[model samples]
Target: MHLSGSPTRPPRSRMPRALRTLGNPLEWTDIQKTILIFFPPIPFTLFYLYRVNGLLADPTVEPYISRPALATTHSFLVGILSAFSGLFVLWFVLRRREGTHDLFVRAVIHSWFVLMGLGAYLVGPFSTPVLIGYQAGGMAVFLLFDVRRAAQGGLVGLLVIVGTTILERAGLLLYGPVFSSVVFAGERPPDVWVYLNLAFTVVLTAAVLAGTGLAMALARARQEEINELLATDVLTGLANRRGLEDMLEREITRAQRFDAPLAVVMLDLDHFKRVNDTHGHRAGDAVLQAVGEVVASHLREVDAAGRYGGEELLLVLPEAELSGARAAAERVCAAIRALVVEHDEHALRVTASAGCAALVPGQPRSGEQLVRAADAALYRAKERGRDRVEVETDPAP
Candidate 1:
């Protein structure tokens, strides 16, 4: 007999769908994301420029460890040039092109990190810790890669810091004629300084990453809300004309591809102007809203209804033939007749006239053509009598 085996461990839960789809920073639109990416470098570039200007104004100011101020000045100028070059390329060259924009953004970020690392080493030991910390934070914010790529980028940044420190020490030993030539030439900083620098780098990097992530997430959410608002009718809680047109186009494409039937119904409130004159505009609005609710409630899941304009509504029904469309229009007409709106303590009842048209196979039917046919039938229904449904006859060859 075999011995009993140990229990198997449970499988790990997968990441949430939203978190899994958190896109790369480079994938963001060039306008806002690119501007934000370049923000961190602005402060450092300004600081360097200020320092260089001050040193130039007062040439008698003592150099750090017998190193000339000109070397630091040159470093600052290089950083400013790099920052301007990146911005120019983004605005002028990349413009609105996403593919090249993404590549350019990533390249600029990597180059900025390299420039900052080199500047920190050249600036001397006294300022190395601060520069390295800032560089680490900036990299964490601007890299905007996925977890694996971000981790690799972070590792590269760490290597930059450590390698710069080592190279500075070597230069000191070699008596190189540069900024901080004498100070780091002999001895390295204390181990406590190194530990403190690492600690500061880690803390700042975490803060920048978290802050950037939160801001980007909020911006994305706001954009979605704005789009929804733009596509919605404020009064009827239905799709606006523009939104309706978009849905109609998509349904038309699907119907054409599948060789299925598609239908549209155009409805107009009967004697709507009389109601506005007898009661008031507010009462007319209430009637419109009531009509919207009735039409929406009567529609099937595959159908979409939207406000065509004042006193009018349109419906799109996919996979529906002419007879089916006429039945749907009759139901909507009956539903509107049953709706009662209360405005200023007045009970108002309204009726709608509808025209139905269906796609004819082997005939090229467009959204505009279908809508115009329905409108013609609607005009006929009104000419005969209101509160009825009329179906457009087949188009002649």
Candidate 2:
């Protein structure tokens, strides 16, 4: 029989594709999405081992006397169950579709529950101090794993402690053996209930702090991206004037400290306006893009390149001398001459003129002076009939 009133609607499996795109599904990377699935219940298995070791280490403990072999066998059974649950998690991560987000939510919740349950079972019968430490350790782990949304885990951890406290209280009121374990040691009964409450408070406080710190970190990352956009040029993806100045100031100090050479290359597209008039503005933009790409190819990982303004571009070459800077400029000129941009079914070629200047060691100069020296060399290249690299004879000292 059809479940819906309208049989023409067909089954939900045949629903429109548009309806499926309404909600976003959370996704994880390949390693996180695959390998973690098979290892979900690993913590619980280790907890079981710890519990067995605890009992074996001291048979006079309350847990050993209460049930002895039964508790040991129960822990081993939980370990076996965890192994199966791990297999299920692996299958869910790989094959589950259309509800992957919901499955992730459920999986994380289930993992949290198992950790809390294991922790409570392991430490609940122990002295107050040990139980408090155990719960604290669990809270720390949850914070490290998922600090952004840690409140949910914190609540689960609190519930586990509360459940343990209720059981201990009931045991003390009902059976004398529960009280004998704590009080039998001394006059002071170890204050198990107080310790549980303190642990709960500590976990809750840590979760709140973690959430606040995560939010601040995300905010700082966004701010850095915005600043980068403001300091960068949109066209050639190079640093604008502001970014160039910042780079110069930063590199100057390093050059002074290490006594290394630093050089600057100022380049301009020769007869740029003539090219714009002869071809078109679109062609001019293409020429600039091609030149930027060529120069970028020659730059090392530590160097910085940027569009200064209009047809001019700036290059900062650290640990380079005047001769080295001249060589780099020549390479840049050759690279630009080779740039061929496809435009209107024609391969358009362009050439660039370059000026090279090196910073004097142990001599300080303003950023403007350095730019002016490079700019003078650029003009010299233009005066020498363009399309050539010129090195400044007198650089700033």
Candidate 3:
């Protein structure tokens, strides 16, 4: 047996703190990131293979000298791709061995750092559009990882790229290794090189952005769920005390601004302790939950209710005058008196005493003052007799 409005849903199971960080809120799974690690190198390797076959260059328009130069350039690009692929395996190996994500992540952080640096190197002399695109999109990986170590690794990678460009400009290294006057054995036409690099840059950036958008959407949804859990009352499905106070403050501001009448009604279940003592806490809870429904059903959309504490609820009614507020509280009292919560084989019932306090418009009154007035009147109702309503006479703004 259960009360009419008591929450009966099973409680949400909480994940362990460590497991929670793995994917539910923010972190991508190791498998997902591992696939990302594999994808980056494939395109670069294929592009270099195409270069080895002169598929990218127009031999009629570009300079061609030695076969050895083309082979050397192809080897260098392939080497970078191979190095990245070979090292990326550590992310998998260590992930299996340790099963501690942070341990594997820290182990592979430097590998990612080197990959980013080399990725920038392939298109960088600091001024290349492809390098700029890589930097913009590459930051998404760090965002997905979101460990402090990831940040440190990414920063080191960026610094190496920047330092490399500085050194290249100073003639310590080649400026635009692939973009310089004679690229390998044959120089591709300037416009062809530009178009190809631009295409690469666009594809690279778009992939990163698409992945980040999906991951961030998941994180944002989880955050909203957490916020709701923090603010809502699990038992009555109303705002809790803290959330109610915040609402009250905002309503007070609205009343002053729009010259609207506002009233606060504080309701306390009569003989609540006796219900717990005689019928057990479960029955008392049933009584409270049923009464919460009684108060909620009496309210309009503009009205708000919250559990102020045990066996007590506070309602905020907007655009309500003193008499209207008192009448509303009486209705709530009548409704609570009618409630019959069926617990086990017994039919438990409850009654509520309510106090109404209206806002004195154009007066500098705080939310606390309004609640105190209603609270004081609530005690008066109790003193007079249980199951009744009382209106506060003193505005005391």
lDDT of 2 at 208: 45
Taking the tens digit of each residue's C-alpha lDDT, what string does model 2 give over 350-396?
67888988889767766677778888998999999999988888775
Top candidate, metric TM-score: 3
Every candidate's lDDT: 0.68, 0.63, 0.71
Candidate 3 yields a Cα-based lDDT of: 0.71
| Model 3 steric clash total | 0
**Candidate 3 weakest ten by summed lDDT:** 60-69
Residues 277-364, candidate 1, lDDT per residue (tens digit)? 9998877777776777778889999999989998889999999988999999999998878777776777788889999888888777
Residue 315: error of model 3 in Å?
Answer: 0.7
Q: Which ten residues in a row have the lowest lDDT in candidate 2?
A: 1-10
Regions of model 2 farther than 4 Å from truth: 1-38, 43-107, 110-115, 123-148, 169-246, 258-260, 271-293, 296-311, 321-324, 341-345, 361-363, 379-385, 391-397
Q: Model 2 residue 348 lDDT?
A: 71
Residue 321 lDDT in candidate 2? 91
Q: What is the lDDT of residue 381 in candidate 2?
A: 93
Per-residue CA lDDT of candidate 3, range 184-277, in tens? 3465446655665676666666765766675566666666667767766778777789889988999989998999999999999998999899
Candidate 1 lDDT for residue 102: 52
lDDT score, candidate 1, position 336: 78
- Number of the candidate with higher TM-score, 2 or 3: 3
Error of 1 at 20 (Å): 23
